[model samples]
Structure formats: structure tokens, C-alpha cells
Target: MKSALKISGYCLIRKNRVVLDGRVLFETGPMDFSSFAAEAYLHFNTCYPKFHKMDNLSKLGFLASDILIRDKKITESFKGREIAIMLMNSSSSLDTDKTYQQTITDRNNYFPSPAVFVYTLPNVVIGEICIRHKIYGEGNFFITEKFDAILLDHIVNHLFNDGLALCCIAGWTEVNGENYESALFLIEESSGTGSGIANFGPAETESIYQGI
Candidate 1:
């Protein structure tokens, strides 16, 4: 039987708040990005201590994925290798890159921390999510001027057709200074479970993204 793609779950985070599948999970008054992220981490009960040490980009991805996968039960049913991740953002870790650059900009006070420097790459956020969820499948990160749901849908469909993954965590995650947003979806082959929304094509994906 041919596999039918479906959207099993989704999460959106923005403006110091998190919403999972149309339900508000966490919300806080005005606060810095770092503080807001920390509050979300604590509210989600994520015991990952390293979350505090990660750069803003990684923290955003980690927190968003943590809520989506855990609340949606993606990891419990799908093996680590069966799941893939494809994330995109406009900033492309420029937030962390600028921070890292500041450290070395002053030669006399130069003190580049490996922890901060390591997250300079946008793909590092994918690595952090994979490590947290033990997902060893294929993953990619793209930098685009804005969210491209059609491009994301095509890439994820290719992964499924090529037998590279059975499920995918795909979406846009962007963080720059006080501005941050993420809209992640869990796409999987329909097994007649009757629990997921059917027809996960480019238009459908774009609609969902736009609705968020």
C-alpha cells in the first residue's frame, strides 16, 4: 500500500509564549528572550541542564522540539532512526555568530568560549535536537528570507520517497535578539490510525504555517 502523508502534531512558539496543537502551553509577561526561554524550559519540565548553556538559537529549537515531540508522542512510537528533521530560518544562527564575534572583536579582552563558538552554525540546532531526542536519522537546515512551506514539503516528501525516513520534524525556527518564532510539525505516513489530519501537501502545510 502506498503511504499517505499526514500531519500528526505541531507546535508554535513566539513572543514569550508556546502553543501546542492550538492549545496554549506556556505564556509569560514581557521578558528577555533568554529569560523567556528558561521559563518555558522549566514549565515544560525538561530536565536537560545543558539547555541553559546553549546559545539562543539552540535553545529555541530545543524548547520547541521538546514540546512538540513530548506532547505529541512522536518519539514514543517512532524509532530514532525512523525520524528525520528539516528546519529553516532566516537568521541562520547570525544571532550567535554576532555574539561569538563580539568576544574576539576586542583582541585584548578576547575570550572565545567553545560553548558559544560551537553553536555558530545554524545546523548546530538540528544536532542539539537530535541529541536531545536521540534521533539519528537524516537532518538538514536551510536559510531562507522567509518561511517556504512548499520547499519544506518537497524536501520532506523526497525523504519519504527515497526511504530516508518514515517520519519528519519539519518547520521554521528563527531567533534574533528579542525576536523569536518556531512552527514545527510532525509529518508521518498514515497508518489508518484515524488520529492525524490527512493530505499533508504543500498547500496544506502552507495553510497551517500561515494560520500559526
Candidate 2:
């Protein structure tokens, strides 16, 4: 059985769509998180992920890390903040896997691109997020046949209480060729707002995904 999670802010995104349904107001991407970043800056109280294609693990890590900061005013908000990233997917960087194989197979592969090679693993996203955000905290990756909201909720709840991440960017970044869907949330502990958990109930997951 998964333990309960504590979440404050919940921001969801899907297919370049940024859904602001909670206290935090932000954006995600239009092939990049630039617009999302811009919105966050304006709001001064939200979190958004970084933008990068390939829908790979590293990118997901980078995305989550970008949002876990406390003091948006601080030069280094991620500093001293623990981050627990819970990710879901189907292919699990299979795109990178095939690409790497192609790179190695080419006899004339003069430049063995280490950059591409690094994103082959599922956990690379976790590593990238931690490194970029300077988050020295707990991280976990889950590769399932499809998106499971229950699993995400369970993991996030535990991490919050354990003090792993003051907030989390948890969701599914599934890539299928050029067509992909990303439903992510910036989950955090409460600060004077109502318990975000109350937002949960039957069809709650779908509602969050819908951004309504």
C-alpha cells in the first residue's frame, strides 16, 4: 500500500498545454519552456518545467527541477530544498535507445556523441533535475504501461512527509514518435491555502489533466 502524500500547489500540463488549476499560476511549453518560464517570472509564485524535445528522461528531470524552488525571489531558490521527482512513461527513452544504437552502428561515427548517450536511462531525468536545481534529495522513476494517478499520488505523499522534496513536479511525459503527451504537476506542501488533497476524488485525476 502506498502512503499518503502532502501537496499544496498542483499545476498540470498536456501536449504543450499548461493547466493552472491551483494557487500557482504558470506555463509549460510550445516545444520549449520559455513561455512557461516567462509566465512564472510574472506570477512570482509558480513553478514550470524546462523545455526540450525527445521526451526523454533527462528532459523530464530538467523540467521538474526548474519548478521546485521556494523563494522565486532568491538567486538560488532550489538551494537547500529537497526534491523528489516521480515520473511515468511508456517508451522510457526508447527513442534515445534506438538513436544510440544507430550512432554506434555507423562505421563512420567519428563523433561518439556522449550527450545523446547520457539520456538513454530512465533515471537520467532525475539526475539532470537534481544537478541543475542543485537538489540533493530523493528521486524515483516509474515506467508503467500507462499513466497511473494513484501511484503518483502515493509516491508524492510519502516524499512530502519524509522531507525529501518541499515540492515535486510529478507526471507522465509519454513520447510516441513526434506525437507525445505530457501531464505534469508541481506538487508542494501547503502554505495557508486549503489542502490540495481536497481537490482529489473520483475523476479528480482527469479534472487535473483537463486543467479546468
Candidate 3:
């Protein structure tokens, strides 16, 4: 089993804007998809300045990790630390898939853009996180009707017990056309709070998806 993990910090992005920085966590809001994407791009660009403009999921993932590291103070100290991602999305990258389909529909005169294909899967975000942080740990993504606290709590606990990762960046990053909102948390073992993962009963669960 992996050693017990603690949630030292957290960061959140909402409607593509930096609603929550470092220790802040914001509730979801009603926002268009394009606006959210643009906001994500903007906040990421501002936070990562040098590397945020890269037009790739991998770069975005790295930027996200960088934010967490800088905010949570988990830096070179966690160079080889096992980290996992449990990212959830509503559409399963339907937006990118639509673009990809458009490319294929006109194969006679169309060639798939590598950029669109790269982000056709929700887990692409996780891959980006892993690559940027050097996390050689277990990673998974799910398409849920909406966020569910029960499933998240159970899975996160399993990861800790199984030694998959010391901590996890578990949340939803859904972008469809021009509507998007995200509410994520940094879940880890902690004796300081409730019961850590186990204590995430109904109350805590409800807390995660506050604006749902």
C-alpha cells in the first residue's frame, strides 16, 4: 500500500476564469462554452505566461500542474512522487470529436488536423498532467451525467490504499462549444480534517458540487 497522503493545497478554474487561486475553491457558474475555453486559455496564459500559449492539451496539462505545484508548494520535492488524475467530463470531448468528424467527412479533400485529434479524448488532459509532472502513476477519466461524490470518494481511497498515487487532482473539465464550468478539489489523505477520503460523507460530497 502507498504511504498515507495529505492534501497540502488546491486550485480551481471556473467558466475558464481563475475563480479560485491556490487555496481558493469556487462554485460552478452558468457560462458559455467558448467563453469558458477562452477564460481557461486566458487564466492559463496569465499564470503560465511563458508556456501557456502553446496550442496543445499537453501544454495545458503542464500549466495546470504548474499551478498546483506553485500554489500547493509541491515542487521538485515531488519530482518522482506518484500522482494520479481522475478527470471527469460531461461530453467526452464531443466538441473536439465534432471537429474531427468534420475533417473525416471530407476525406477526399480533407486531412485531419493533428491538434483537433489530440484533444478528442477527455483523458488527454490527464495525459498532459502526467507528462508535465512526470507522474508515472495510475490515471483514469470518466464521462458522468454529472459529478458524483460517492464514486469519486471511493475511487480516490482505492488509489491511496493501492499505492497508485499519493494524491489526485480529481474534478471535471468540461467544454462544449461555448458552455463550460468546473469545480475540482485536491483529494488526499488527511488527519487534520474530517476522515480524509473516508470522511467525505454526504456533506463533503455535496460541498464539492456546490453549484451543480
Best by lDDT: 1
Report the Cα lDDT for residue 162, model 3: 77
Candidate of highest TM-score: 1
Between the candidate structures 1 and 2, which one is better when assessed by TM-score? 1
TM-score, cand. 2 vs. native: 0.66
- Report every candidate's CA lDDT: 0.87, 0.56, 0.59
Candidate with the larger TM-score of 1 and 3: 1
**How high is each candidate's TM-score?**
0.95, 0.66, 0.72
RMSD of each: 1.6, 5.6, 4.7
Candidate 3: tens digits of C-alpha lDDT, residues 96-141:
7887889888758788788778778778777666655577667788
Return whichever of 2 and 3 wins on TM-score: 3
* Per-residue lDDT of model 1, residues 60-165, tens digit only: 9888898888877777888999999999999898899999999899989989979888999999989999999999999999999998987987898888888999
Best-to-worst order by lDDT is: 1, 3, 2
Instruction: Give the Cα error of residue 102 in candidate 1, in Å.
Output: 1.0
What digit string (tens of lDDT, one per residue) describes model 2 on residues 173-198?
Answer: 66555545566666655452457654
Candidate achieving higher lDDT, 1 or 3: 1
Can you tell me which runs of candidate 2 are displaced by over 4 Å? 1-7, 22-57, 60-81, 108-111, 161-165, 190-203, 210-212
- What RMSD value applies to candidate 3? 4.7
